[model samples]
Target: MAGQSKLSELFIKCKSENRAALIGYLPAGFPNQSDSIKIIKAMIEGGVDAVEIGFPYSDPVMDGPVIQEAAEVARNNGITMAKTLEIVKEISGTGVPTLLMTYWNPIEKYGPAKFAHDFSDSGMEGVITPDLPIEEAGVWLATAKENSIHSIFVVAPSTGDGRLKDVTSNCSGFIYAASSMGVTGTQTNVANTASILVERVRNVSGTPVAVGLGVSNRAQASEVAKFADGVIVGSAFVKAVLQNPSDPATAVRKVAEELALGVRER
Candidate 1:
């Protein structure tokens, strides 16, 4: 198993502060590579505790329309795995713990070992593989351990207790607790079942739990933070940039600030 990574440290720090960490997500080359960097920096500046830079893939099974549209824009602008890594290096350089959110096919195409090495070299602390099942993650898990990068897995409310234990045991960083059964997007109400799912995970593993999906504003962040160790906001951040093409950085920064306050208030 890999030792404590920056991702783990962030959770520890958040716990010490009696608050949930604010984790924000955005595609690597959304809008454009140069502008994407600015948007991410704006997220950090606005008080995001950690960052998850998405590897824009054509087929993102877990992503909703908002994220899917952002990925399409990145792909149209020629955002390759190499370009994604460049963005990761820049964001990680800001000294805020950074992670990569990617699908399994890209890692398989890049060669699991090489991909892990390159990701760690880029200064990323972890990788979130939403579609990679624990049963099929042998090579990827081993490679992630070899490179000293945290392997994060996503668990949903629909996951069985037995499966939750299996998946949580393999997780090195925080466990991503999807707030609902469906794909990722903002929701008027974050499912009440999310707290139940978090409790179930706690019964099996001591890993920190971060809730994502349907959390868009400060109130939602505070609500999730009440039970989770971290609150993850993705679609809302992507939408901020998507809606404000002329000044995307400023738009995302404002959203980040609002969500940051949510985590702290909880």
Candidate 2:
């Protein structure tokens, strides 16, 4: 469990193949539960290294328009914490590593200990809560760690060396280095800023660093991989599915393949 649960080792495995990991993100129950499973399976078949299953939260402050809209639709479709857990089990059966992307409120609502135990039992590998700060991570970190679930931490471009080291030290999985100091979504030409941020984070932490937030294309992903071990693409894929939910599996496959190739080409 120790070696199997660490995200950095997973990233290194992907790196050894001369390919950056392609992490796909989708809101659980996006178009509906049926479609969500289809998309997850599509991503796995299309070569995605991992998947980030988003739990719908009414107010996802850090997510931008695309993800925010998808979350709203998921919540409207009656997607709840319990439903997400069930989805985790289904996805796990597909043999692709999965992480739950969520907020703190829902975990608290479900009781941290119970949530962690149940989630681990259901086959989730880890969790990413951008809103959970280093100081407050202690609130749920222990429960998560007890179940061998990695607690993913986020470090922003604005984070100084001291805070960066502190956050990375507490991180068991790969550290997410936000490409910018803003919400998740599309952005124009972030190469320069991304390079500096990646170097800063790499210098501070031995953990594998993943670059996320505002990455939308192959070109951008390739550029980011030059400085980091993994690339996390979310909004672009979610927006693609929302555009054609009836056949989201196809869209997921297409995007996943494209991104996978993009990273592998690097």
Candidate 3:
């Protein structure tokens, strides 16, 4: 059996503190490789509990405009699978648990076993493949198990009770609960359905649940934190970098700090 991952440890620590973990996301090589590394370090300095590095896919169906733009910038700057893994190595070295959020095509093209092993070697504690379903995740799950890494899965408000059980059962680190049934982005108000989805996931499994999508500010983070084990913010962070091209590191750090306060306040 695979041992407990850093991601699992983070959730436990957060639970003990009576607060939700703050997870921040950034695409590898966004703006540029060297600067991207600095930006990730800044996020850590700002109290982000965990990090999710995007793999910069050409067709990110689940990503919103902010994230898609970041991915495009990273791709145009020559970000590749190898480069992404290098970024993972640098950030994971900070002792903060790191995860890669990517589409299934990249993993399929890279070869599942090799991909899993390489990712594990890069110090990533888990992987979140949004497009891959539980029924089709047999090989990937097995390889992730062999690597002693967690196979994270997504559960949305639209997920039915039966399917929720199957999906959560296959997940190891945490179950990603999409707050709404839409592409990822920041919203003025988080959907009420997020809490409902979290409740359903709890009824089916004991895995920690993290709510993502539509969470951009501290208030939204605090609201979600009230019911979730973790709060994931992506587009908001990407937007911060985009808005402050002169010094994206500082920009993202500020956003991380604000969101961190939100989670802790909850």
Predictions in order: lDDT: 0.92, 0.83, 0.91
Candidate scoring better on lDDT of 1 and 2: 1
What does the lDDT read for residue 182 in candidate 3?
A: 87
Instruction: In model 1, state the lDDT of residue 249.
Output: 94
| lDDT of the structure predicted as candidate 3 | 0.91
- Residues 80-110 of candidate 1: C-alpha lDDT, one tens digit per residue: 9999999999999999999999999999999
Q: Taking the tens digit of each residue's C-alpha lDDT, what string does model 2 give over 190-249?
A: 667777987887787777778899888878888877777888999988878888756878
What are the RMSDs of all candidates, in order? Answer: 1.1, 1.3, 1.1
Query: TM-score, each model?
Result: 0.98, 0.96, 0.98
Error of 2 at 108 (Å): 0.8
- Model 1 misplacement above 4 A: 186-188
Sort order, lDDT high to low: 1, 3, 2
